[model samples]
Target: MNAFKSKTEFAQTSVFKLPHSFLNFDNFVSVMTRAHLDRAYWNTLLIIVAAVIGNVALGTMVAYVLGRFEFRLKKLIMGTYIALSFVPMITTQVATFTVVKNLHLYNTLWAAIVLNLGTSVLQLFIYLQFLRNIPRELDEAAMMEGASLFRIYRTIIFPLLTPATATIIIIKTINIYNDMFTPYLYMPAQKLTVVSTSLMNFSSERSTEWEMMSAAILMIMVPIIVLYLFFQKYVFAGIVNGAVK
Candidate 1:
């Protein structure tokens, strides 16, 4: 069959090309050095870490208040968050960019990090799901023992939210890692290239070298693949647990 022959030919070509392409570290090194990717890696790491912390802390607190407390404006607040989630991020890019420029954060790593610090509605919903599974009796008991709200969150609620937190971290890490648009738009300096934007170096207006491009893609993919493999169980666990309630 033609299909079978085509598949065979593709496999053979991949086997022949990929081995040589992947093994050639010169291209990888050249790309990294030329793009100043070492600095980029540090910048990306800082942004991811800082944004994850901010997202988790803020998201958890909001979910905790919305889930565990009874306030007059609760429904309105929840509705606002749900409504905002329906708005597409791309539609607001011009306004967002304007705000970033006005704030004097353009072309700075903090700009990316600050933009990502907002509470993720999905993460908040996940936290709310996990929060529902935790009985109110724990809070009551902790309160009876003179534990402040902060103490309860830190000592009890926070520990129980670990699985969900891990899931959020993994998801956000991948999102931030593959995000080329924000880094390219906000941090255009050649020295500020993240992994995603650095891949642009492989192609141009005239021609694209497929082998080098393939190599660069694999290099970009390796870290994410390794992270997923390592933390896959937590991701599944969070999904399963969150689905239960």
Candidate 2:
């Protein structure tokens, strides 16, 4: 409702009544025209796509190798992952920033993409959980038919992980979309703005344009809300299924 209010109306009071102009799109217009959200949208989309793909490929591969095969130090690796996950990410930002700087990824979209590209323990655990339910008989049967390990993974394993993949994609997309810290810290350029940082346009050292800011907030929120509303069932199902076994 604040999105439809004039500056004066918005400044006056918080009322339960209707907005000053229910049909007024001026705030939305101002946000679109003045803010860099159009460019931000594309930048965000690119990062989300790259990050999701990298995560899924690497995550599934790691889970497959660990879940299907017995290897030396396997327990050590899994333990390391669990231990590292307990460390707060904030504590490592200083070192991470230096590495990104050394790699010359500062102020580039690649910085965000590369930083978010890794598979978290959550994803690994989830994939491993699903993999447990898959029968080793499938692998043996495929091997008897002359199917290579890679072919079996690509055709049989990956295809069956669709529900888990969908869950990861949606979760990762939302996380990247809502994250302002990485983009703001790594890619501060105006052209590299993302939806998370686009709303900064309506703010200033002196005062904020609450009406326009409100409109921008609504716009930024709608996509994520719509996405979750549509795919929430998959998320719930994946989590519940993984947890069950």
Candidate 3:
């Protein structure tokens, strides 16, 4: 009966064998087909798009003001933004819930977009610094040629700023794509999820399914990586934009 008792103890141990859950290609396809890709992946793409557009537009404008023109309170305003950059992100997490609720944006795709769209102080500062590197002589020449401010910006300033803008867009896209917490708090409802939050759900329902998780994570990561790879040159130029001249 010793052998029988040995088997009984083995079965009773924490390491006791249980039915293995196998993940094969068929299971993967089934999961992929069933997974809510639209709610998460597409929503993330939309948010990233909105954030980049808004940031690029507003950031360029702010950079123009700070870099090209001068006025009262300019230093104060720019300094305030720079100071705000130091405030830890954790401090805002608890407060944004109420603001988001008042705005009635929670659990919506707009919630993600709106939350992400505001000017990033760092991006603004980077763009502003880059703008400073652009020679004022270019603007003077444009004005001498009777070029309008808008035309000058469109033809000269904007083109010259391409390196910074592309780099900023790429950086912002990766940032928004990877940002999970803001969406988690502001878009708590599963119906309007993004990749970051969806990844969590994918993890929960398929905790034992690493292959699927790996695939899902890879899917979320690959596009951003590819974008950065494609624009690697601009990324370098952006980094060096203000270093010379």
Candidate 4:
């Protein structure tokens, strides 16, 4: 068929031109050395680790308190969180940028990390759903064993929230990894480039080199792909358990 022949010709001309493109370490080295991607990788890793820890710890603690305890302003607080979720983040960019600027964190990595630490409503909701299934009797039992509130949370509630934690980590990892706009906007310095923004180096006003771009993309994808492969079971388990009961 003409279609088959065209496909074969295209593949031969394009992919086979640099048969070693995917396997070549030279492109990777070029990207890393030329762009100073080693520094960018470190910067990105630090941001992801800090952001995930803050998001998980803060989100989990808030969810635990909101789910387990009844307070006067519980409804109001929950309503506020839910309402804020409905407001698109893009709408608040101006205000957020202003705060970051005033804090003198505009070009710093902390700006990205701090802004992202705010608890995600979706993650909070998932935690609350999982919490509903965990009997309060466990807390009572632990308390009878001389466990304080913090002790109960640390030993009992926190351990039981593993699946939800894993889910949040996986989700947050992907989001933070692929997020180009925030890093681009907040980290304008060449040295502050993250993986997503670093890809821009392959493009220019005159022409874009598709071959190098593909190579760079594959390099960037390797870490996330490996991460998902390892944690996929936990992700599925978390989704199901969080949603079902």
Best by lDDT: 2
Q: Give the lDDT of residue 168 in candidate 1.
A: 86
lDDT of 4 by residue, 134-174 (tens): 89999999888999998888888888888889999998999
RMSD to the true structure for each prediction, in A, is 4.9, 1.3, 7.5, 4.5
lDDT, each prediction: 0.80, 0.91, 0.71, 0.83
The stretch of ten residues in a row with the least summed lDDT in candidate 2 is 13-22
Clashing pairs in 2: none
lDDT tens digits, residue span 107-218, model 3: 7877777777666676776677777778999999999999998787779887888878988887788888888888887777767777777666446643444445555666
List the lowest-lDDT window of 10 residues for candidate 1. 1-10
The deviation in Å at residue 3 for candidate 4 is 24
Q: What number of backbone clashes does candidate 1 have, counting pairs of residues 3 or more apart or in separate chains?
A: 0
Give the TM-score of each candidate. Answer: 0.88, 0.96, 0.79, 0.88
lDDT by residue (1-245, candidate 2, tens digit) is 88889898988968455796689998888887788778888999999999899989998999999999999989998999889999998899999999999999999999999999888888887899899888989999999999999999998999989999999999899999999999999999999999989999989999998889989999999999999999999898878876753
Q: Which candidate is the best by TM-score?
A: 2
RMSD of 2: 1.3
Error of 4 at 112 (Å): 1.2
lDDT of 2 at 173: 95
